[model samples]
Target: MLPNIEIIVGTYEEFLLGYQLKQQSEEDGDQVVLKQTFADKSHAGSLKCVAVQGPWIASGGSDDRIFVYDMRTRKQSQILLSHSGTINSLVFSPDLTHLLSGSADGHMIATRVGSWKTEGDWQKAHAGAAVTHVSCHPSSKLALSLGGDQVLHTWNLVKGRVAYKTNLKSKSTLGSAPDCLCWSPDGEHFTLSGPLVVEIWEIKKAGVARREKTPAKPICVAWLNGRVCLAGLENGSIVWISLDAPEDEAAKNISAHEVRIKAMSYFDGTLVTASSAGELKIWSCDIEKQELEHLTSTNIGCRPTCMALLDLSSFKSECPQTSKVVAPKHTNQEKSNVVAAPKPRGVVTIEFEQDENPTIEDDDNSTTSDDTDSAKKSKTNHKKLKQDEESVGQSDDDDCEKSDDSIADFSDSESFGTDGFSNDSDSNQRPAQRKRRNPTPVGAKKAKPKQAKKE
Candidate 1:
């Protein structure tokens, strides 16, 4: 059986020119096909961002256009215009009634989904710097935008103007500002991440709320489970942090990939991570142990920039017979909906060989092992294993409690004023605390050494 739901990944190419995740037969394996590879000639540039809602899929491009396609009809329904620079982010409001797209020119264009019309002055937001991310609040009445100016700007959707802003440069350092931001599921809090730091801020009714900090530079972030948010790092690791934990003890880091993680999404008990090197892996998450078990890894053969999952069960009435639209042989057909187990052949598969244990002969001068001590060691190991099994649930509950206490303390002790932007001069700037990782992965092929100069 094929998965009812499927994953769509956007790449550096023009629209409809990348891959779709699929599974092969039970005997074969899972794979990604370069299936959706055609685009209209009218669209003139590389795609930068994409979003899907119901049967409509919207994509923004370098040509400063937003193209909306009807998946059912397999045709472009609308081409939204009005931005002067590359459109980098397209996010649909939580209620699915509106769409927001932010551009390199530091402007955001909000469009009503039903009418495809621009919403008031949301067109020219973040006038000071390029908007890197735009996130919608759960209430659908407000939104947040993070820009190059190192400020967190909030917009009142109804009023069509900036409601409040906070200068985060003072809390961190200049030029080390946040590049990505995400709102918590409940919309009561949000997080800012850049080099060497992650800051979470509470959403208050007026002005600004409290802020807490942790020390990990995450390239992407998404809420994992209750109270835990997963942050993907430059080293290809995913750290699940509790919002209420103390800064130092908040994060549990798990090295996940060999290249820089570029995109991620979590649903049910599975977490999907994609790396810039074109590798994608699925893992079964254990929220109690704070551990992830590797499930399967697939190489999609292109650098994935973004990803989203649409549960098929929710749209079964709209989805055509997938077997007919997607050829059976071309798509990966599974035996059933079993959680995928790691296969022997993947881009980053590891194979280990075992040899027979070496036999050791003890001579008269050699040290002799004590049978009684060996028995004691075995008993100790047994007791430790039992304790570990019993403490798994207990430890998780205790950590949650401690985190709640720490968060409450921070909220009660912090304060924010209206004029919070920093004005320190060059002489007062702090030393650089973080640097970006190399673009290429380790062990990658390098250019041939240049010919030595003739003597």
Candidate 2:
């Protein structure tokens, strides 16, 4: 059965095309038709990358802009100008609350979905190096990105900062960054594609679990299952690599195209592969049987840079949102060379930061007696606070009585006015008028009044 879904493609011709499978009478068979085509209205440059999630389809351009389209309304809804360079990649979180973008400017930004606001962003994610590709974990709590610096960054999505860094060249075998990176749906492993090689790294211990050499250099890759991966090769062929199989065993390979493959995406047993020669084909992928059947093919007549599948059947009227946009946290370890730019302030926000004076946690190796002593000390401090409060209240009352006595003593004293008489009428006495005098140094005689000179 054909899945109720559509594919959106980004082309070098500045055109974003959407295609859906249309079913006809049994005699005619299913057909692929162009559903929507958006041109020129978005950016003046070539479309570099694209992503689709829920009801929104977004295409990033070389002009440093991302145009968001409403698939349900068939209209251009929003445009994001967050990146300063060519947008390299775009991925929506599993919860559909945030759209994460990576650009050639070495920045990774996360934008909120509903309000269309930039929640938090890693200012310079790659330390002034361009981010080649990024993949979000199935849990959406973590992400992995490859950059021009040859480091693979494990981004803590909740903290909006790099959690760990690994050099792809740490091993002599995998000395260069891969062209593609994808997290397995199970979140246990991620596949990295390099020239004539594929590396599957385990997320548990952060090490390579499997490595297999391919017949041709891999250009793009998509996971067909937790253990099976489809790699599109530089020689225009697709190879099914099974991580469960032994290293010496040969995996399945098919000549998928006559030219180099540009990109690939898979969903619900359906695999879509695109060639740099402008051909798009859908295949029925049966991972359990280790079989791939060609279902249908279409020609966009224009070369595509990237493509993403938008499953209409999976659209949600309201998707679960990300709980909160976490502010970036800075630690002493952030001083590493892999560190990027500072926290955000406004629309591209990173409001909260680490405290200047951070409290340290108790060591796990502490003894029970030490814990008991700490508990006892806390109790003693609480008791002391209560005792101080009681003493303060008692002194407050005593001080109030002393103040009353002092007021009576002062009132009992007599007051004298300028008339040299003890007078009880203080309100009737007026202050004597004062004459202006010259400001002179001490011990100097004051100037006589001008009135004396007139007299």
RMSD of 2: 30.0
| Candidate 1 lDDT by residue in tens digits, 1-455 | 33444455666655343333455545566643323434444457776777776766788878898888765555678988878888888888877888988898877878889689887535446654777788888888898887777777888987878898878778553245576577787777777765766656665644223233334457888777547778888888787777667645546678898878888877777777889897877777887788898766777667777776555455434335555465545324554554679888533322223433222343331233354346558978999999998887566555455444565554354332233322345546544212222256578998998998999
Off by over 4 Å in 1: 1-3, 15-43, 173-175, 204-216, 244-250, 316-455
Residue pairs that clash (backbone atoms under 3 angstroms), model 2: none
How does each model score on TM-score? Answer: 0.62, 0.66
User: What is each predicted model's overall lDDT from 0 to 1?
Assistant: 0.68, 0.79
lDDT of 2 by residue, 1-455 (tens): 77877888888888888787765555576554434444444678998888888888888988999998876666778989888999988888888888989999988989999778999878778888998887888888998898888888998988788898988776656557666788888889898867678888897767888887888888888987788888888899888888888878887888889998998999888888899989988888887787778877878889888988888876554434468878987777775756577998533211222653323343343564465567668978999999999997776656555444565554455564455445655666664322223245589987776755555
